[model samples]
Target: MNGVIVGVRKDSQTYVNMKRKACAEVGIMSFDVDLPEDVPEADLITKVYQLNSDPDVHSILVQLPLPKHINEENALGAISIDKDVDGFHPLNIGKLAMKGREPLFLPCTPKKWHKDKGAKSSCSRSVRRSNIVGLPVSLLLLKADATVTTVHCHTKNPEAIIKEADIIIAAAGQACMIKGDWIKPGAAVIDERSQRPEQEIRIPIEASKVAGFITPVPDGVGPMIVAMLLRNTLDGAKWVIGQ
Candidate 1:
């Protein structure tokens, strides 16, 4: 598998490192295109187009939280949908929302929540509304006939909402914001928020004793993200060779 990553933030360096480690472990060839924070949107789009045309590149990932000057939609649009390993392309998400139409790939993080982990019921709560994770997971749960409640900044009594969910997905990016008491006993929990090491350890350690299953910050959905990227790259490579 071969892929290219475009990023701007110093924090994004960690993602690059993570991806590299994952690629190395799986024997996937990787390439990176790190741009300055001040890079023009057009230049970023151009870079994506160039990688899109490269025969050796099976997947293209443009890291999120791009500089203000760069329009994320334009940058992501420049990538070939077939090579959208991150699965953030509009078409991929659109297909995910439509019944009976399979997306080329599911967004890595959200896709992991499809299975209910020994929860007492299929009632689920999503703490975000982004196209990437929250909405997709909610839609997938709806498709699976699970009762889904989506919480956002405007939601009243978010804790009470959480208490009703048999499956809880915290992707709001607030580190350790969700507590053990917020979780129903025996509930399945997926926390995708990352905080500092000390703070990150708190949620899992606390929630594990309450929730039926808790995904630790590092070993949980994090590794699955890299695995999914490789999987999508392999799928893109297969499509390229008409296999």
Candidate 2:
């Protein structure tokens, strides 16, 4: 496993460290490239390409929030799809949302919530339609034979839509955006929003009283994504070794 971090923002630094710790726990060899905040775009992309070409490197993670001057797409696109453990490549995401096609890897965060069983014949509401979370989760639910309704900022009567579903997944990145009343009683809820100071603290407290199973913000969804990344790295290694 290798991490290429550019310019160190707090979130990027924290997550890279978390990945490193997880790598350590799982016995994956981890390497990092901490470039200056002002590193040239070409230089950064070259580093990613180098990692992609290295046979020994099974997984490649470039922490989010790259420096302002960097072209996020070009840098991320330089990574081989096979080594895109973060699953940010357009090809990977496209295949994930489409039917009858499999991606090299599922987006780590969303894959954990994309259940193969138990959600069948259920109606689920997914908040946000962003590529990373909402869209993929909805596709996964559809693959599981569940009816999925996606709600975004522009949706009307969002609460009414949410209350009708048997499952709710909130990934809007907004704090306390979905309240307890929005969740159907006895419904399973997965909250994916995380921000500093935890402005969304009330949802879990309130939802727990009504929800059949509620995932707490801090201990709930985030750790699963980390585990999936590690699992993806191991899977990537297996693919590389043809075992």
Count of residue pairs whose backbone atoms collide, per candidate: 0, 0
Q: Write the per-residue lDDT of candidate 2 for residues 79-130, one digit (tens) a residue.
A: 8999888788989888876889888888887787764347789999988987
Error of 2 at 57 (Å): 0.7
Report the C-alpha lDDT of model 1 over 89-142, residue by residue, as the tens digit: 889888888889888877877765554343234899988888778888887777
Error of 2 at 160 (Å): 1.0
Question: RMSD in angstroms, candidate 2?
Answer: 2.2
Q: What is the lDDT of residue 233 in candidate 1?
A: 81
Minimal lDDT window, size 10, model 1: 194-203
Compared with the true structure, all predictions reach lDDT values of 0.78, 0.78
Backbone clash total for model 1 is 0
